[model samples]
Target: MSRKKTNIEKEIRALKKRLAKKQSRKRKVRIVARSVISKSKTVIFDPCAICGVREATTRDHVPPKAIFPQPRPTMITVPACSECNNGASDFDDLFKVYLSMQATGKSEIATRLFKERTVRTLQRNKSLLAKIKAESKSLLVENTEGESEEKLGVLWDSEAHDHVVERTIRGLYYHHSKKVLANDAELKVQWLKSIPEEIESILELLTEQVIGDDQVRYKYYIAPEDPRHSVWLFDFYGAHYTSGYTEPTDS
Candidate 1:
């Protein structure tokens, strides 16, 4: 009986050891899974991922920054015009439709709707900004082949946000300097071809910064009814176009 008892004790000890080993393996597997998930989901921006501007730019949302109230908001993005950013409020209804589609996992439909609304908005406004550039052979013309090439329409692919930002930047640059408008415009279009890699770098940096800062809220802001007129300054130069962005201290 004593021998049998000793044998049972030994069996129990072996079972516990095996259980512990299995648990350790499971824990390791869980850690690996979590790591992969994090790497996959974390948004990484490259040289110009969100914006696509090669130099002197700030990140802008393709969906418009004003969609969310503040503090912590998530939306689609690209490098954008200060005009685009400030004017985002005008796209409230369209964005709501986009949000609905996202919630429903109807991306195809959402894409179609977004494109349609965008085209309509551009058309109704009669901005003719692109047309003016094309007709005048302005620096904003993007590219030209002795005026024989097909006039490039604003094309929005899967990377619509990035494309929009790219076009806007080209337009802004062209407007700023009529001398190299055509060359810059053409170069800008080609620049987008390599955007996938660039975005990865920008996203990685933004993520690291966000993770490092525990205090500041990383979110978009909607300007009040009357936004500052200076926002238009981005239509020409670098991101820090404003030396003074402070709100009024008191009335």
Candidate 2:
């Protein structure tokens, strides 16, 4: 084949491949949209799952949409007020970036997210990058080969992490009970990574109450005595941990 002709043929094949992938993504998005529409019809009357103060104006995906490949069939959404929905974006971005960094090699999605989204965000916001760098600390992380190496890891904002956890707990509560928690309901989050020996018994009890058959990625347990008190366990690309606790508020 002539050199120019061969190059033309290659370009045509690449274009066709891109078009096919785009169409496939579109189809998946349509399917998810239909599912959201159908589900929204049933829960439109409910109040915002997060704060429970305002009427639910829209649906918010439990795990922020940015973390998933476009048009994921597993995407689940819950009712949220505009404030609750829009307020989560910054924290979501931070959490996803943290997870992406942690799962860089093990997950292609995480790598792509880090390169395409997180890098761009950091580049655009020099001040934010500076703040993160300023707050960073040195930590010893074990590599796949089991050798510990000192690394500078960003100090994640506790408030941002807590907000994401609180929002997720509210979404899960709605998913399970079809009810909005009271606006005054208090959420206490405890990271399971460094729990004290005294709390080991409580953790064991919570472990036994796990509700889901699928324990690979995520599992949750609602206290049998009171639905308001629940626990969520998450395994994000092998970063396994549990968080979330609902404390009763005075009536």
Best by the TM-score measure: 2
Clashes of each: 21, 0
Model 2 per-residue lDDT at 234: 55
Window of ten residues with lowest summed lDDT in model 1:
25-34
Q: C-alpha displacement of 205 in model 1, angstroms?
A: 6.3
What candidate 1 gets wrong by more than 4 Å, as runs, is: 1-110, 127-191, 196-251
**RMSD, candidate 2, Å:** 19.7
Candidate 2 on 1-251: residue-level lDDT in tens?
67765554344333323323322111000001111236457433456777665677899988676554433436668988799899899898877766666556665655666787778888988887889888888999998799999977776666666667667767877777777654444555544442334434334333332222221255555644455545555555554344555534441
lDDT winner:
2
For model 2, where is the 10-residue window of minimal lDDT? 25-34
lDDT of each: 0.28, 0.58
lDDT of 1 by residue, 115-212 (tens): 55544554575643354334432133333364544432332222333233333333333232221122111211121121233223222221111211
